[model samples]
Target: MAKIAINGLGRIGRSILRLLTTTEAGEGFEIVALNDIARPELCAYLLKHDSVFGLFPKAVSHDDSGLTIDGTRYPLTDNPDLSQIDLSGVDLVLECTGKSNSREFATRGLRAGASRVLISGPCPTADQTVVLGANDEMLGDQQVISCASCTTNALAPLARAIDTAFGLVSAHMTTIHCYTGSQPTVDAPRGDLVRSRAAALSMVPTTTSAGRLTDLVLPDLAGRIFATSVRVPTASVSAIDMSFQAQSAVSEKQINKMLAALPAPIFGTTTEPLVSSDLRGRPESIVMALPETHVTKSATMARVFGWYDNEWGFSNRMIDLARRMTSM
Candidate 1:
């Protein structure tokens, strides 16, 4: 079986672990180790809600260091540094730490014998940035991979489709993203200057790096996009609202046809109204094309909606990408 290690057990990290234990997609891989600085309660919560494995069985072994699931006992290491982990047998390392991206972290995993490291957030190194479907070919053996944020995952394909079909002129997007575990329910001292405000009560305007990363993934559209984000009061399943000005005039039917042409596993289009709750627990990050609103005016602006269970959806893709890398 493929062995995997996850670092940082926060919202995304915990969701990844749960996905590995509960989902059928994770059958070929085993989570050999998990790391987090949170209290033990956090880890216990993760072990309790697995959809497939459920709570850890009584026969499972536990010690002051770590617990064993399915006869694999991963001793918890006190160190949080990615360089310190013993990854000799690990096929892939899922770096879910929300900490700013570091080339050192990816390099450390490679040096420690991990075939590849998949980063949860954007990587500081320009070379490591790649989106799953848009530039999946960029991933190869002996390479570090970074999955761009959820907004990028949702919008890139839409942008790519439009750019390919009608030619993209410029695009602007506003992502109505759900509040994450990283945000405080109550007003507290802001850890990051931008997120210090109350997240539960109000919609906060924030900068999005998706546009920048989009250019990186599809270089042909470089410097042609702008994006912003609003953090709303919801647990999971964020939505993306994208408006694109196509270079060549295209009708609503044409845009819908182009979007619908994408593979179902990559893109989804529907006549039924799509909502965030409808996308909850959805395994793939689905792009729900809004066909009715595609206007065919001078600057053909179309509103496209997409859904992503940011934590689980992105992590699922990360694991699939890892598995493909290891040929497992």
Candidate 2:
């Protein structure tokens, strides 16, 4: 079994462990340690009671020594700096700290002695960036990796599928995303004016890295795709509203049929008029909303819609990358 350490306990971090400890995906991995700046008690409580995912299915408890899940004890600590930790036995470090774009932070686990580092979100400086079906073939001996972001994970596959079938000329993507921890429950100060407002109160127009990151995965589409985001009031799940210019013309039926044939656990298709909440725990990268596929009269231009459980789907991709890196 490969030894693994997690460097954060936020939504993404906890979700990663939740999948690892509870599913067969974690069969050949061991949780060597957990690191978070939050107190051990709060970390344990958060693990026990997740606001969006509900309580973990296994027993969760923590003491000064560490965290115990499903009766297995793993060392847990409140360490602000990973360089100070001794992760000598850890084979891989899952860096869920959203700020890992900083090469210094992404490499901290390596400095601490871990064999590899897999960041949860986008990191331009990472040795490689893997987006499952879109670009996982590029994964090899890279020591520092960015799984890309949740949005990128959901968008890249569909974008790739469209490009593969219809030939992407250019694309514009708009994601109606759920609010995240970066936004406050109430109006407050944040990095910018739009995000500083109450996250749950109204739709806040923001930006997405997928526009640029998608180019990284599908280089042929470089400088051809752009994306934007609107943070909505929901607690989970997000929507992808995309319009693409394809070299080949396709009708609405043709587009849905094309997406319907895409494989699962990565991409899926459904005709149900499902709301965002219905997609809460879905593991697929993106579930194409068949009924929402709209083709222009010219057929050369089209609009598509899909839903994604940003946390769960992205977390699963993280596990996929982690398993590969650990050679599990």
Best by lDDT: 2
Q: Write the per-residue lDDT of candidate 2 for residues 1-328, one digit (tens) a residue.
A: 8899999999999998888888877888889889999998999898889889997899988898699898899899888899899999789999997888688989999999999999999898999989998997899998999999899998999999999999988989999999999999888999878999998899999998998899998887888888999999999999899999999878988898899899888997788989998898898889999999998988899999999999999998888778888883
Best by TM-score: 2
Instruction: Give the per-residue Cα lDDT of candidate 2 at 43.
Output: 91
Record all residue pairs in model 1 with backbone atoms less than 3 Å apart, i.e. clashing.
Answer: 190-196
| C-alpha positional error of residue 201 in candidate 1 after TM-score superposition, expressed in Å | 0.4
**lDDT, model 2, position 41:** 92
lDDT of 2 at 189: 92
Q: Write the per-residue lDDT of candidate 1 for residues 1-328, one digit (tens) a residue.
A: 8888887776667667666665677788877777776555546556655542245433344466785656556555546676777788888878778774667765676677777777887886725666666777776654677788777877776678778788888888888888766677777776666576667787777777788888888898888888889888776778777778876667777777777788745566667776777777666656574544567466466666667767667777777676776783
lDDT of 2 at 217: 86
